[model samples]
Structure formats: structure tokens, C-alpha cells
Target: MNNLEKWFHSNLGVLRRISQIGALVLVVLIPILNKNEIYILLGNFYSLSIGNLEIADPAIVAQTILLTKKVFLPLLLAGLIPIVITLFLGKVFCSWACPYFLISEMGAKLRSIFKTPQPSLKNPKPQYYWFIFAGVMLFAIISGVPIITYFSFPGLISSNIANLVLCGIVGVELFFIFVILLSEMVFDSRFWCKYFCPVGAVLSLFLSKNTLKIKLNSVACGNCEKLSESPCINACVLNLNPKKENLYPYCNHCFACVDSCQNYGNALTITFQNKEK
Candidate 1:
């Protein structure tokens, strides 16, 4: 195996778990630190300020522009970071740093222990999510309020974390997240990430042909036929067929499929390639 593949094999899910957990820790710790009067990191996922660098969620940025009908230079600059990241890395924030996505993944793991059957809900088309995003933006324009950010699970959960840490109380947002998590466990897995999630939907708009994505080798994948089924597909919580080419706007670049493929034929590898390739 090559060096990259070798590293992926040895590390498996370690790096991702560390990143996800680290993000969760930051969500809570930032508020604690701020409560103690530290200002190095401020704000939550929707909008954050580290040192002098301001980073805002693009979805929220769009809403702000629509609501105010003007663009502030700082807001534009704050929004650029995530857009650049999405251009190069795809919508990795959902998989790597989203607090809600992390909790949802944990629920999926717990269900796996009980040997729960996979949710039979068919995956929605890419346009379905984009339509929701557009509709949300349109509503913000009409209602003169940024409704999308309010419904952003990641932002809401992180804000709630900050609220709990700094203010000593949690809001109704936690209950909303709990309901979503419970529904995911009993019904469809990653239902919100797949279907709704305006943040994910907005981030996906930056996906380009040259962005990072999962690629499959059919010959190596065919070798996986020796087993009952492809482990890559089983590893995908989103129920994506990694052996197929159409992964994106849906893929969070979690690398679960690539890691699972390593045990079989190392068929799936993440690479920067054209989507049509």
C-alpha cells in the first residue's frame, strides 16, 4: 500500500473521531473560557471570531445580506473562510465538526449494537435539498428575519452549549435536537443531514468538480464480492453506494467507506477529481 493508504489503514477512524470530539469540546470549552474572561475564541458555529479572524456561516451570511439588503465588508470576509474551505474540502464541517452530526452518529452506533435494521427511506435527490435552501433564503427575504440560522442544528446546539456553560441553563433547542436524534434512531438515520439542514445545503453549493470526493475502483470493489456484501456500503450511515460515482452533495467526506474498503480490497479512496470522472 502507498503511504497515504497505509496511514488510513492504521489510523482508521481515529483522526475523524479526534476531530469530531475536539470540535465538541471546543463548543463547550470556548464558552467556559469566555466565562472565565478569555477572549481567544468567541461565538459558535453560525459565526465565530478567533483572534482577529472572523468566520461566519455562509447560510447565515446569505440571510443577513437578504434581510438587511446590504453587504458589510467584515461579514463578507468572515463568510469567505468557509466558502474557501468548502471549495477545497467539500462540506466536511458537517462530518468533522458539527455537534449535531456527532451526536447523530453516536445514536447510530448505539442502534448498531442492537442490530437495528437500516432505515428504508430512499435517499432524496440533490435538488430536494437545494430547493429547501432556496426556499429558506426566499422566506428570509419575505419575513425580514433569518429563520434558517435559527433552525440550524449545529449552530443551535453549539449556541445551547455556550448558553449552558455561560448562563447555567439550556434552552428549548436541546429538546429539538433530542427529538431529531430520537427520531433518527427509531426511523431514518441522518434524516436531517440528508433531507433538510440548510447549512449543509448552502455549503454544498460550493462543491466543484475538483473538490475532494470519494472514488471507487470497480475491480477492487468486485473483490469485495467474496464477502456477503460490500463493507463500504455498510459503513455509510447515509446509505450511499460508494461503488457508484454519484456520492456528492450527499457525501460529507466522512471517509467511513474508504476505511471500510481497506479491510477488503482498498477499493475506495478519497481524491480530488472531477465529479464526472
Candidate 2:
């Protein structure tokens, strides 16, 4: 009933993207602005601190834990922070903070413009790839490599950005991201994120059946009979049926479904602590 773009523009999901883009910007600025270690609050991808608060990627912790079998309180807390947040907020970090998401979203958009053909998954269970990632990390940890740092997409992008600016050292990790970009452009666009991030998989282990989630009002959803298809499912990057309760760990909490709903039935809403919107 209104300009489609305007309708899309009116949702709260834009705030999510803004925060993600903002974090990406800060990664760039941190290395550029802080030449002297005067600021202790700033940090890179695997770990970050704001004043006394430290947040670390739990996958890094897992790698270290597997290697050392001992938990250092400070680093343990650093890693647990993100995991704990995931437990309460769903995988908000993937949708709202990862730098790789912006690039992948652009690639996905471009692929859509070209009508890029993607093969349907034989096993639609998205977390299968996450397990593959976890297995690799586990093997690497056992092999004494702690290789998640060397191979993680976000870790690489965050590491390289910090290295290139801070130490003037460029590594091969950028090439890895380029290859992933090409993959998204030519094939399954949301493949890596939808199915495979080890760090995301690690964080997902903390998600519970009822932890902050999307709720569907079946009556309102069913009454919207004029639609060509289910917008909630179509809007999902991870190919999830947002109207269902069985959302897997792959959900990034991107809220694209909410944005796509606009003035429609509005049956799908994110619920915090079992409270209805």
C-alpha cells in the first residue's frame, strides 16, 4: 500500500545493520588511531575490552582449552562473555557485529541481481556445516596448531586489519576472504555463514530451546492470504521458517523477516524473555 522501499526502511532491523557496520568501522579506526598502547580498552577480533570488561571469541577459548586443558580466569572470562551473551540474546553477534556479514550481504545482493543459481542442500539441516567446522577446530586443537586463528574468516579479516594498520604486515588471510567472496558471488551466497562458522557454532552451543527467540502468532499469520508466499521463510538468509518454533542455531537474528513483513500481518516478532511484542 506504500512505497516498498519506504516500508522496508521503517523497521528496527536497520539498527542491527548500523551496529554491525559501526563495529566494522571501529576495527579500522582502532589500529589507525592507537599507535601507542595508551588505550587499553581497544582490542581485535578474538578478544576486546571496554574498560574492565573483556569479551573474547569462545572458539578461541575452545582451541586454547583443548590445547592446555586449564582455564585462565581472565581469558576464560573474556571468552565466556560472548558465549553468555549468546545464551541471552541468541546469535546477535553474527548478525550485528561480524565484518564478514557486510561483505557476504553485498555478495548475496549482487548474486540475487544476476539470478545466480544455487543448488538446494541435500541435507537442509544448516548446523551440519557448523559441526564440520567444529570438528576441524577440534582436530586442529588436538594436533597442536590452534588453527582457528589462521583460518577463521572473521578472525582473518579482523587480524589482518589490525596487522596491516598496526604493524604494516600483510598476510595471506585477505586472499582467503576474496576467495570466499567469489564463492558467494558464484554459488551458494549464504553458504559459509548459514552453514559453517566454527566460532558461530561454538557460540550456538549456549543457545537454549527458549532463549530469546522469534515467536509466531499463528492466527494472524494464517489470515494473511493475499501473499504469494511465506515472507518470513523467504526473507531468512539461513533458510529458516521464522513462523516456526524450531529455529536452529543458524539464525543470526538479522531480523530481515521482520523488515520484510512491514505492514503485513506482523505475526513474526522477536520475543525477549518469553514476553510478547
Which structure among the candidates has the greatest lDDT?
1
Instruction: Enumerate clash totals for all models, in the order shown.
Output: 0, 0
Q: Model 2, poorest ten-residue lDDT window?
A: 116-125
Q: Model 1, 1-277: lDDT tens per residue?
A: 6887689655757888899999989999999899899999999998999999999998889888879989998999999999999999998899889988888888888877876545332344677677877888888888887798778998999998899888888897778878988898887778888777888888998999889887777666664643336677777867776665456788887888788877677777788876533
Q: What lDDT would candidate 2 get against the real structure?
A: 0.74
Residue 183, model 2, lDDT:
86
| Residue 99 C-alpha lDDT in model 2 | 88
Report the error of model 2 at residue 277, Å. Answer: 12
Measured on C-alpha atoms, candidate 1 has an lDDT of 0.81
Across 134-172, the per-residue lDDT of candidate 2 in tens digits comes to: 678768866888777676677678878988889899887
TM-score of 2: 0.86
Error of 2 at 33 (Å): 2.7
Report every candidate's CA lDDT.
0.81, 0.74
Per-model RMSD to reference: 2.3, 4.3
